[model samples]
Target: MKQRNILISGLSLVLMTSVSSVAMAQCTATGTAAGFAPQYAPFAVGGALNTLVSSINAANTAFLTQSTAFVGSPANPKPDQEGGGIWARGIGGEINTKNTVSSTYALGGNGSTFQPVATPLTGGVNCNTTTNLQFAGTQVGTDMARLNWNGWNVHMGSMAGYLGARARDTTAATPGINAGGSLSNSLEVPFVGAYAAATYGSFFIDGQIRWDFYQNTINDPIQNGLFNQKIDARGLAFTANAGYNFQLGNNWFIEPSAGIVISQVKVDPLRATGTLLLTGAGSIPNTTTFSNIESYLARLSVRVGTTIVSDKMIWQPFVTASVYHDFAGAAKAAYSESNNPAFEALSFPLIQGNLTANNLGTYGQFALGIAGQVAGTGWLGYLRADYRTGDRIEGYSLNGGLRYQFTPDML
Candidate 1:
């Protein structure tokens, strides 16, 4: 009877120990799941901030590069022993010899009639030269992910990145301007940004905003009359888009999207290059009151995309292409140098001509990306490249990031 009692006690002891071990293992897994949320939350927030800043930097660099190509002192006769210096700073600075036309008179010799014959001449002065400016290359990076719960999908994220652009001229070598040369220029913009998206049924919409700070450099030959200048700027931009997802059959889908972007910003001038370019005067210090300039841009785009979803693995891959058109915008100066005695005679508008808004031709973009779920969470990444047939703008973007979803239960 005592042996029977001992056996029963041993079985009970083993059962209790096994149950306790299972309980501990379960608690550990639950704790890890809870802890992951806190860790990932901060990481995601920081990433969004960084990407917003990066986007702003890219926009500013593009703006400045385009402005340089459109604005500058006109070509003039070489500063020769003649009155070339005066012309270089005066009428020559205002007129592009390449596009200028003038009339001259041929005198009738004593053997012919006294009336002078009129003649037209079309040619750039032999001493006159023109230099074109452009940003040699530009690149942008962003990281963003998405979240889904119940019937709605929400994606909000950020990224940090870099963009670089160089200024080149027609006169520069085939490879174009190096780090040096008056016409050669370059800019590096560091930034951060945030983007958010929401979807209901087949309809979805998204938007992103960015802020950036940048430093720019310009090198131009002296014949152009304007000295080399450096510019710094802080900028802000916003873009919003709407689209509809059309389910094809199986896991295939197509989405058509439309979007608009509006941007506003200003540059803090380190030098009054505008004043010098117009009047051929010496460099003037840029003051907030006198040198402040404002710029605005608005653009529209349409996109078509296709998606492939794999059920075996939690992966969704997509390809999208878009075309953008600039509709309206302007860059203007607050104060006109026309009031100043030195500039009044030249009839210089207080605003630089380049600051005046004009159409920046059209451009296109192609993007490819993949998204998937990990450990019941979500993530996404993509890359895009842009091009324009004209000399206006060109660039590329690389993006990767995370996402979170809110469900009806959470709501």
Candidate 2:
């Protein structure tokens, strides 16, 4: 009887152990569902690229339209030299940032074994961005640093203040992001920059250099399904232009210009450094690095205008047409999460993903502008209606500004 009782107890204990092992077989993924979200990789990266390019282009356009068409060309009568001065300008506009985003994401690592089920992320996204820039500062002339030499005229303006740029996903029920609404992004970086233009004889040149930040913001950090922290990026961008001034007659003139832009941008990795609980025996590492982004843009423009002089005021009116193209290819982002050398990446439902964005090829623009100056006050003002004529990225802006020359007579 004793021997039989020992055998029964041993078998019962073995059976209990088996049941416990089977009960804990499921490897639960811990941390916020966002920690495991593979769908957002493309949406964030692609949206960010679109925003960066659009912002750069917006700054370029603002710089181009801020001034009048009356360059110091031999075709028109030369006005007396006006000393250094101050200027204040404001610009508010909107542009269409269309992107073709595609991604590959993994799901269903719930089984007891290591496996990844990749889901196609081909649902397109449409984001129209609203942009605002304010500029106010001193301009250099012959009186300041000999900035003007021979017949050359140069003035520098600074754009340093709070800038607003917002891009929201307007699509209907963007899949894999929420249960009811789409994911929206906002750029919180403050914009700052400077622009310079010089005119010598029948030749002219203008350019601008500005700092570009690539951070992205969403309305809700936590999605109904999953979400993560905001992404951060930073870079530098600059635009250069050159042109020659010619005349059709004493009152009419023609101007042709060429411009180019070059920039270097970098995107920060997601969950750069952190470890999440695996709910079983190990931890999940969160980290990903995007490829380097280097881009170049080129454009051409032509302007025709006439100068009108009257007793009370002088007016310069012109119309401009231009075509531009971006030479950058799409950015391909690589994703990885297994940082622990000892930890097995394929053990659970670990994710492997990739994302990319299409580049906007060629765009056109049309603008109408008028500049005027008071006969005796030495005060100059300009107003321009600028429009993007391309179907892919069409938009418009009404920009205006006031400038004053600080001369001895004024004092």
Find the candidate with the highest lDDT and give its number: 2
Candidate 1: 10-residue stretch with minimal lDDT: 15-24
Per-candidate alpha-carbon RMSD to the true structure: 27.7, 22.9
lDDT of 1 by residue, 120-212 (tens): 111110001122222222223332223334444444455444545543332211111111112444566665666555555556666667665
lDDT of 2 by residue, 34-139 (tens): 3334232333323333333344344333333332222221122135444455555555565554444444545334332343334321222222222222222222
- The TM-score between candidate 1 and the true structure equals 0.47
Off by over 4 Å in 2: 1-82, 105-148, 154-159, 172-181, 191-196, 213-216, 220-231, 271-288, 337-348, 408-411
* Per-prediction backbone clash count: 25, 2
Clash pairs (backbone) in predicted model 2: 34-227, 109-349
Residue 355 error, candidate 1, Å? 6.6
The prediction achieving the highest TM-score against the true structure is: 2
lDDT of the structure predicted as candidate 2? 0.46
Q: Estimate TM-scores for all models.
A: 0.47, 0.65
